[model samples]
Target chain A: MFSQRKFYTPYTSPTDPCPPIEVKSYETPPQLYLGFQPPCLPQYASAKEALHRGTLWPALYSPYESPYKRGDTGE
Target chain B: MWYYEKKLQYPVRVRECNPRLAKFLIEQYGGADGELAAALRYLNQRYSIPDKVIGLLTDIGTEEFAHLEMIATMVYKLTKDATPEQMKEAGLGAHYVNHDNALFYENASGTPWTASYIQAKGDPIADIYEDIAAEEKARATYQWIINMSDDPELNDGLKYLREREVVHSQRFREAAEILKEERGKKVFF
Candidate 1:
């Protein structure tokens, strides 16, 4: 038997009273019908930096240099 | 819209000449659940997907092209030095009879990869879920290939491809939840 077993019990949990439920106002869910919230973009030093991060445009901006930088040599 | 990358995404330096493995590897390049199917599926789906999710599709779809190259290169290297007798002995003669040692777009069973392997449902929810499923299938296929192979050179590449599938699935799940929530708030006057 571990001596630490008795020390593991938190005395507050069982003796704690049921917390009062705070009443909240009827909150309508956020909707595009009301307005739109765009995704928060990261701050970049420059356009090049953003492009390098591939955040501005992923398809057009490649993060790394092209693999086929050298001239095509047939096998 | 596409550029040829002469190099593979992952280096595949298979030292052994196993045409049989090459035949099986072809599935990853052009099979039903292959990288080509994934690339084509996501790229085509991008057109119909919501603007917010287009980037996700574009990024993943484009990356699939790199995987396609990696798998194709593996196949090429595996069979590059295989003799006709070796090819026949390895059961690659059927493929050889059709296209010889040159790479032809086909699955392990020699079925040509077709556009029908994927579809753009025009529904974001369905398409994104389908994308996740496709990734899972591709991951399983890579595991199958890894199981059959003892080559360390090949396993490294396969493991990388398999890990990518897990990441892609996670991204798709995020995209799906966003789409679902956005749809939930829709109302008619």
Candidate 2:
């Protein structure tokens, strides 16, 4: 007969807890870089406000004016 | 949901008709690392891409179709009205024997286009990285094509195509960063 798969059982309290691995990242991209900004949801009144609130994800924090916006209206 | 652009993203006005060069350039049209492959890969991947980045995928993928059309125009212009003797001398007689000056689906070296040239992994990170790589490869191909000829008309279009690849790579990079944040994955950019 083929071996039947057994369901995973809950861990007993006798085992040591798994240690967390900390990754330090200096290569993390910023909200704005080299005259370009990654796409961001315009939730914050300003990117300064988002940074003040400690929002770190780059895509969620755009700071540049989009060149694609229509200029005929002169915004 | 799409509107046709009456003009090419860049004009493929090849001043000289060179079947030999056309044979090489055709790879960018239908080869493994060609515009058609780029268009199909991104378009197919968009359905599985996160909703926020779907707009990026669709826009870039649609632009790839324009590049595809440009390549086709170049190939067609190069081969149209080419004499049978010219075709044979240019080592395209084998292609002419089969296609008779028509645009058949084949790479620069006459390999038939195949769907296996691309991937639709349905993973946003993986697919976007693949997209980025595709743009780089396409850009390199355009550069190699440019190096082979001094035709101003062809060079202008090829340079524009190469520049678009750089812009597309940047967009894909932005899209990947967005998807990473959306999915809460932490990795260096």
Which digits, one per residue and each the tens of the lDDT, describe model 2 over residues B38-128?
Answer: 8888888889877988888899889889988988898889889899999988888899899899887789788899999999887788899
TM-score of each: 0.69, 0.69
Question: Candidate 1: interface RMSD in Å?
Answer: 13.7
Question: Which pairs clash (backbone N, Cα, C closer than 3 Å) in model 1?
Answer: none
| Cα lDDT tens digits for candidate 2, A1-75 | 211111233444545475421221111123224224535634656765443332333333212111122122221
Local accuracy of candidate 1 as per-residue lDDT tens digits, B1-189: 777777766667786889989878988988999999999899999998888899999999999999888888888888998999889988888887878799987888889989999988898899998998898788678767876877777776776677677557757877876787745575979
Which one is best on lDDT? 1
Tell me the lDDT of model 2 at B61.
Answer: 85
- CA displacement after TM-score superposition, residue B50 of candidate 1 (Å): 0.6
